[model samples]
Target: MNGLLEDARSLELDRLRHDVHDHPETGLHLPRTQQAVLGALDGLGLELRTGTALTSVVGVVSGARPGPTVLLRADLDALPFPDGPRHACGHDQHAAMLVGAAHLLAARRDRFAGDVLLMFQPGEEGHDGARLMLEEGLLDTTGSRPVAAYALHSSASAPAGQFSNTAGPALAANGTLTVTFHGAGGHGAWPHRARDPIPAVAELVTALSAVPARRFDPFDPVVLTVGSVHAGTRPNIVPAQARIEATLRALSDDTLARLAAVAERIAHGIGAAHDLEVRAEYTAGYPATVNDGAEADLVGAAVADLFGAERFLRGGRPALVSDDIGRVLAEIPGVMTGLGACPPGRDPATAPGNHAPDAAFDDSVLPDGAALLAEVALRRLAAADPAAG
Candidate 1:
């Protein structure tokens, strides 16, 4: 490890990682997590701003000289599980790595010109905290918008230390769907006497499962998972309303729109056939996380230089996984890369996937992840510096 990565190693990220991991919070408000971040960055002397609508921390680091501004982000919210909220997605690690980067960069503030915006955001798990931060004028923290922005994520299924990202469409576009069928309630024994919504919703579920294969081209893949379904309380009585909730994902916006439209039509058609009124609400979530080609090439070159050629992944298409950072990239040119942090002794192929209860992230990658973030900012700042020429 070089000087920067070595310093990241000594930062002792476990204390903060464990503390936040042990007591994880979700949604827009993460008071305890926010406090932990403030405590870590206490003596750093960076100008900081906290979110009014959310528990977001935006720290501005102005270098000794003036140039352009670069932004780095980390999502701090944990995924909610059946047992309890957990850091199964490795967000805790992301937080630690960014903290390490902040310390490392602060120690050598004279090396880089311009400013660095440290974005510690919440509600990344199906919540658009990035959008929230942008709404609150995150880009306006400095006098001008960031010339370039960067953020990295941890992957439990990839070999540790490897960095992977694509130039275009690194992550998929997504939306959340909720369909409710309203009907008159009656005794189950006399189903013919009244309109029952249970049958409509139940039929819609099966029909939706077949939508991708039947309606969409097999080449352009679409994933629609109906994770939640609800209906009447009593089995003997027909419920007045039945609802089903689903998550939608597509590589392109047009595909996602078509998928949503098909779902709504099928749901309404099923409800009408059953003599019920249907309310299909498809709230569009995050957009496609498209990366700038030059910015992405910079990430690959940095990884290859810092580690080795093998460290930078070659080719991979966008996946169904969605991230709120898409909101930031939409407004500014940026790249969201992925770092493999899967723990040792577990095969990346067979290890439990991210968000799994047993998913684990190796703390050893903290230094590398942190170093890469700092390196990205420095490179952007140097490129923007006229004196560097």
Candidate 2:
């Protein structure tokens, strides 16, 4: 562990994590969470900028000597469930750890070169916060665009304190799928005369569900989940239209596109077979998060050095979850790694996973996460211009 994460600093990080967790905010409207982050970062001698569009906070820490720039990002939004707002995704820990990194890097600014841009982003849940920041000049904020970028996410289903990452395609791309079937409305008792759209919609759902297996290669994974289906409003009257909403996930861009195409084809064919008009719309979401090979290697090495080789896991299958930080990786060469935050004594396999309402994150890993992120920035900056040290 880095000496910078002393006992006092660790305690402070824990407090920050818990404090943020207690007051979870969702989406781009996180005013309280943004204020909390700014407050924690108050004393760090950084040039701070707040988002004009969303409530994002970007802090820049310049080293004593000149060199290349690097970005370290942490998302600041929580997921909003039907019950209310929740931090089941562990974004509170992300913000706390990044703030901790900012403190460590700011204090040791004289030891390294280049500037560290701390990105505390909002709306990462589904609102494309990173893209909004980019539109508002995230790259231009530091004067020199970052040569590399890094972000760490906390996983509740991994062993505590362990670091895991994949070199290519670290996360899947996400897209929304909507399919509607239109038919004639009539009394439910006279099914033959009704030409019910509900049956066609159900058939389409089954066909859409089978698309990944029937259309694509088994090795190239695609997940299509029909989360919602709506058809009839009353038992006596058959509805004129039925709709289905699903989420599409794929590890590659080509596969993502192919999945959408196959879904549309299947829907149209099924609707045509039943003499129903089918309308399908696929909206692309975040792109797959592809880590730069060298940067991923750097992350592995940094984790191995700071913690140990045993704590580092490599070359695993990419996560199916999507992150808008993929937007940043798409623009620059960088890697996003995961730190295990599962509480002690719990089997990761059985523990509640991220986005689960009951999901829990171990606060103990906050210091480790902070140290690892700071070390990555420091190492990258040093490697960029070693003589500047």
Q: In model 2, how large is the Cα lDDT of residue 302?
A: 90
Badly placed stretches (over 4 Å) of model 1 are: none
Candidate No. with top TM-score = 2
Give TM per candidate. Answer: 0.95, 0.97
Off by over 4 Å in 2: 7-11, 386-389
> Model 2: per-residue lDDT, tens digit, 240-325?
99999999999888899999988888889988988888899999999999999899999999988887899999898888889998
Q: Write the per-residue lDDT of candidate 1 for residues 230-315, one digit (tens) a residue.
A: 99898799888999999999877889999999999999899899989989999998898889999998888888888888999855
How many backbone collisions does model 1 have? 0
Which 10-residue window of candidate 1 scores lowest in summed lDDT? 1-10
What would you estimate as the lDDT of candidate 2?
Answer: 0.90
Error of 1 at 389 (Å): 1.9
* Angstrom error at residue 17, model 2: 1.0
Q: What is the lDDT for 48 in model 1?
A: 92
